[model samples]
Target chain A: MHIEVVANIGEARSDDLLHKTVIVVDVLRATSTIITALANGCKAIVPVETVMKAKEQVQEGDLLGGERYCKKIPGFDFGNSPLEYTREAVQGKRIILTTTNGTRGIQKSMKADHILAGALLNGRACAQAAIALKKDTVILCAGTQDVFSFEDGICAGLILEELTYTLGEKNVLINDFGLAMRGSYLHSKDRLFETLVSCANGKKMSRSGFHDDLILCAKSNIMDQVPIWEHDQMILLPRSLARSTF
Target chain B: MHIEVVANIGEARSDDLLHKTVIVVDVLRATSTIITALANGCKAIVPVETVMKAKEQVQEGDLLGGERYCKKIPGFDFGNSPLEYTREAVQGKRIILTTTNGTRGIQKSMKADHILAGALLNGRACAQAAIALKKDTVILCAGTQDVFSFEDGICAGLILEELTYTLGEKNVLINDFGLAMRGSYLHSKDRLFETLVSCANGKKMSRSGFHDDLILCAKSNIMDQVPIWEHDQMILLPRSLARSTF
Candidate 1:
């Protein structure tokens, strides 16, 4: 199987992603937030690319949660921080989410056969979940603004590493992007925390005194959830319910 | 000083390249051919993205050259091989060229204050030329058909390494794309020939019986030519003439 990774969602074509497994990553911290909300028993996440789109999705049972420039949007229930996704607040509620990059990446991949949200927080599980699908994969990084972001690229590399290492025997193939991300992951693996803190998004968070968000984003393989896209929203299936279609 | 490396030209906006120095690389053939043609004393080369556009630029003194897929077009003077650009035929002649990706990259950066072609052949000279200008630089890799091309990324990385190392005292800053290329270059530097032969483009050229072109492309830093974009064409100025504009 061939794996392609687009550093930006702008490079993705709907036709190419059609019927293929697409994984969207925004490490600090859209995907992290989605997986956290789902793992904590949130009903579903409706990922919209823009704040206006999120506002349009408001309902009595839906919580508006996301960020614009790393700040919680006015009237939103939560920002992009995973720490804000505690069970007490989000349990059994639908979430309408919008962020600078990650949601855009997801909306771009709406044609994907199986769309999943991934991050450094749930990297190993996310990789394994994609591999189990047995379909060609496209890993899209949701960069900050329209430009490439540091933490996201490294997170993409981590997933690529898992996919390549675990499924090497299957003779999986990767293009330049996949190879590039693998190299990025290898280069930054030893100093992931330091690397994240030095990137633009991290500096933005740190400058705004969001040290806890950085620490949470740095923790790897701690969350075993994979937010699978279905019916216009993302919901994590319990491990027992994750076999065919979540 | 700041250096931004767009993984491919598709990600670059014209406004972003406006009044900035742009360096474009297509290591597989287009830029390599341009560098080779200029190094061999060709008067000027016009790089066009499409075959029909190259046909439109035909003139009494200009020779048309380029490729469709790794092979020469039906009625072109020569295919996009550095070997075909030898002094005996192309010396003192203008070459109007079209290729799959590299020319598109050049045309996209037409609004730049200073634009130049770069490749593995003249990597160091190209990087040094950009560094001497002391302007913020954008290294655009002419990836294959809007996708990440392996050799181009490595060539970009080599340029980044040179720029960072030479201007160490100036505190050169690189973003995620820059760091990714640097890592990619370091990963493939030791085995450039092997690396080139294994990439998708390399394999296509090899399968089509262009082993010689692959070897030429794999050889780095042999040519000292820098084809600076001037007046809608690329021409190389001698070392004495290169200080300000080449």
Candidate 2:
């Protein structure tokens, strides 16, 4: 029941992931987009490491949506925007995602015993899903270009706080960075979005006019469906599990 | 400054380490051994990745010490025990040290702009050294057998805490795992050794009769020198510069 937090996907590997339940967090956009698409009724999302691989993975009918530098690639049906994923646009369709960070992050955890997509949008659900598995958990935050991102760390804090509430303190294990995030959350609860926009990685996105994306990521508990990775496809669960019952 | 916490040497090879200050920690023994050797008046220590390479690296007059599976390899002058690094035995002598984990951890940071060894014995010193450089730092924990180790996590926490005290709250950056370690330190400050021994990796080591090693590792402030890797050698400093004067 010990929970471990790794700095980023680059810090985790296939062997290190063995026998551990993994919750992947990419709060800026990729994880949010995956959660939004699946919550809106998409069948599945296939995540790939590179744009070229994702293009080849998509068949004639599957929709492609991802970004390289926070913008949509030419011919991509959509960029890494939660707003682009709606019931009308993504329902009953398949998405081949290849974001610069998130998809690569997911690919790195391909060997995880249990992999779940997490973001501030579905922070509660991710924690709930982890508690349901009844195993030690490892939370891997997809940091920005291998650097710590306040947005992702804050989202991980939300999960850590929720999991601690549900699973009890004894079952919880966090690293120094995780504790700092929880501390940051407490210090900036009244100005969460403002805090998100102030981080180094967050400011980079802001300068590129992605303030709307930051706002979308700031909203918490917008979705309850846990996006679980099974085989090579990322899928969603209908009902959330409560750790108290487990 | 940003602080990245890596899980192991294997995962630390990502492109992010370039141009960044790297502080490597193998607190169980490698780092502690290096710190102890330097503090006890050893001339220099050459760290190597494997036992075969370690033997090859030693010169005619230098002593070799290494271990595998918690036992000393045959023909080495000593095993991977800090207690063996006595001032009378190692004074002014060149030592070539290798171990199952620690040396590999140091070698992995060869690409880093600045590399230093970190341990609870020298945690404050390591942080001070990083802060004096006035650059972002990455804390690479060389956990046991390429998996997360509780002892290393807590040691990294102490370093993070020291950094936070010296740098302003916003100036210091930590990943999710780093945050979690800080939380563990606060929650289990009184029984740091007991808590670590109860962890999965620690339990395994104790079961294998390495409990004494764990006890030695829990001690703090034994060495005041900061061991920095410069020009392919680990050199000790008077005191770390990252600490606050106040």
Candidate 3:
């Protein structure tokens, strides 16, 4: 399979993502939060681009969860932190989420046949989901405000490494950016948490009192759940569905 | 020191580059070729954005050197390969050089206080020169046709690593992309030639019968000379001048 790793949402062309599996990665921490919320039994995540749209998407039982400039939106249920997305707070609930970069990335990739939320937390499962879908993939790194972020690139590297491992090196063709990300991931695999802490977003998040979130988002493949976009909402792919494809 | 590593020439902003030392890198093989030609005692290199501009820039006794689509331009004295620029051929001759990416990078960086050509072959020297210039630095990777290339990223990584080594890790503040490039470089430093051979540009160059260029461009710090833009031409920075700043 061929994989194209884009640097950020701004660089991803909607035309290029058509008929391909686009894995939207925002390691710190939009996708990470979505994965955590879904894994904690949230029914689905309605990711919108604007704050007003996020509020409009919400129904009676839906919760508003997102952040702007790393702070929780005023009067929202939660911020963009995986740690805030707990089992008790999010169970069986539909969440209307909007953030600076990640949701925009999801919206930008609306042209893809399949869009999966990927992060270091569920990289392997995401890779498996992509393989099962049987399409060439585009790993779009949701960088901070259109600037390339190290955390997202590292997560892209993780997903690429996982894909390479499952498909064998000869069968997987990666773009130059993907190759660089893979090398970056391999070099920092042993110290992911530390590596994230040193990156631009990580440092900002840490200064904003999101240290726990960083630690949580930096863990690789800790959760088996992979969040796949369906019916305009992100829902966890059933384990049986992924396994049966193999 | 603050360092910003841009992914390609298209991403480099002229406003941000002002008052900074910009290191333009095109490891496979524009910057590498310029460094080779300069080190072979070439008088200077005039980098132009177009073939017509290159032709117009050449004066009496000046040799035209460059490539279009990796092949020597019609009736030009040389191609982009560093091997073709031997001492016997380039010594004391002024070279009007233009290539697909590297020259474009240099032209884009013209707004900077200082512009230096960098590659894996002169990464250390470029870092040293930037330090001596005493300005915030920007390493611009002249990727292939506005897309990121692994070779130039690796060269940026090498320069970042060298900067960190000389300035100490805490003293050097690098952008997120620079950090990723540093990690990628460290991961592949032990087998740079093999790493380059496997990259997108490397494979293309090799297939086009420029395997020797890839091998030569992949070697790190083989030359101590750094090419600096001075009075509209790229000339070797005198060692005395670099040392005097210290």
Candidate 4:
């Protein structure tokens, strides 16, 4: 029942998250994109580490959805924005997803016994699911290029708060970085998104004109569908697929 | 000034810590060894990444001090424990040091414009020296093999606390992780030393009978002579020859 939220997949790996139930978050778009795609009825999301891998993995029926620097790859089917993962376009189809940070994060977590995709969009659902699973959980924020990202930290805080709220504090074992993320979120709850954009990773995304994507990605608990990773594939969970999933 | 505490040397590199002044901490003994060697009156500490390089670099005048794990190597002059760095032994002597974690961390911070050694024993001095330099600082925790170690996090918290107290909150840019380490210290202040031994790295040390080393390493603010990196060598500050530097 311990909860550890590392700054990124790198930090998560350093924390020895292999045997733990890991929840990977890339709020700026990977997790959000995958969550949105799944919520819209996409069958399953296949996350690949690199764009080259994504391109090679896609079959005739699968679509490529990812970005290099928050922009769509030239030949990919769609960009990394969640707005691109709509019901009409992605319904009932498999997607080969890759991104600069997110997919590589998932690939790193491939060794975890349980790897769950998490984001502010589906944060609550993800937390509740982790709590229900009732094991030690490691929240891995897929930070921008292994550096700390305010967006990822904020989203990790939301997940920490949610998990702690649901599971109680005694069950939590937060690392120093995780504690700071929770404190940052609680202290700046009102301006989390705006303040986040000023951080190192946030500024990079803003300069890339992906600020709008931040708005979409930062809305806490907006989406109820928790994208759970099972057997190396990301699929909609029972909670996310239930009648009240919307 | 922005102050970030990366959990490991690897994270420090990924975060582009080269742009800032880096305070490297390997609390379980590398920094402790350096601090002790200096405290014991050692002239300078030459940090090398690997044992082979450390062995290769020492000359006729320099003494070699370091360890691979808890055990001292067969031919090495000393173990990593600070207690072994007695004043009579190290006085005015140069020590070529390498350890499993600490020396590697110092080598990693070679990319940084300015690098200083940090430990719980010298946390205040390290913070004050970094602030005196008036540069953005990054506290690089040399966590055990790239993972978050509780002892290093606590030491980082001690540095952050010292910095915030001396420089005021407005003068520091506290990242989410930094804030968390501060919170962690506050939450467990009464039993800080007890908490340290319970950590992953600390327990291993305890089990290996180096528990005394942990206690020695955990003492806070014992010295005022902060060691700084100059010309790839860690020496006491102030370029004056008359200064009683180790």
Question: Residues B30-141, candidate 2, lDDT per residue (tens digit)?
Answer: 8988888888999888888788888778888899988877788899888888888899988998888886677777777777788888888878778878888777888998
| Candidate 4 accuracy as lDDT | 0.77
Q: Which of the two candidates, 1 or 3, achieves a greater TM-score against the reference? A: 3
Tens digits of per-residue lDDT, candidate 4, A172-244, equal 7776557656655655557657755656666677888878877777677888887778766799878733223
Interface CA RMSD, all predictions? 1.7, 6.0, 0.5, 4.5
Ordering by TM-score? 3, 1, 2, 4
In candidate 3, stretches whose alpha carbon ends up further than 4 angstroms from where it belongs are A244-246, B244-246
C-alpha lDDT (0 to 100) for residue A42 of candidate 2: 93
Give the winner by lDDT: 3
Cα lDDT tens digits, model 3, B78-164, are: 987889999999999999988768878988988899999999988888999999999999999999899999999999999999999
Per-residue CA lDDT of model 1 for A119-200, tens digit only, reads 9988888778887887899988888666777788788888888887777825778887777777767776877888788787
Q: What C-alpha lDDT values do all the predictions have? A: 0.83, 0.77, 0.91, 0.77
Query: How is the predicted docking of candidate 1 categorized under the CAPRI scheme?
Result: acceptable
Q: Of the pair 1 and 2, which is ahead by TM-score? A: 1
Q: Write the per-residue lDDT of candidate 1 for residues B1-246, one digit (tens) a residue.
A: 788888777777889998788999998888889989988889999988788888898899889998775678998989988899999989999999887677788889988888888888787887778866768899998887777787888888888887887779248878778877787787677788888877788888899998999899887778778898888899984575444222
Superposed by TM-score, candidate 4 places the C-alpha of residue A32 at a distance from the truth, in angstroms, of 3.3
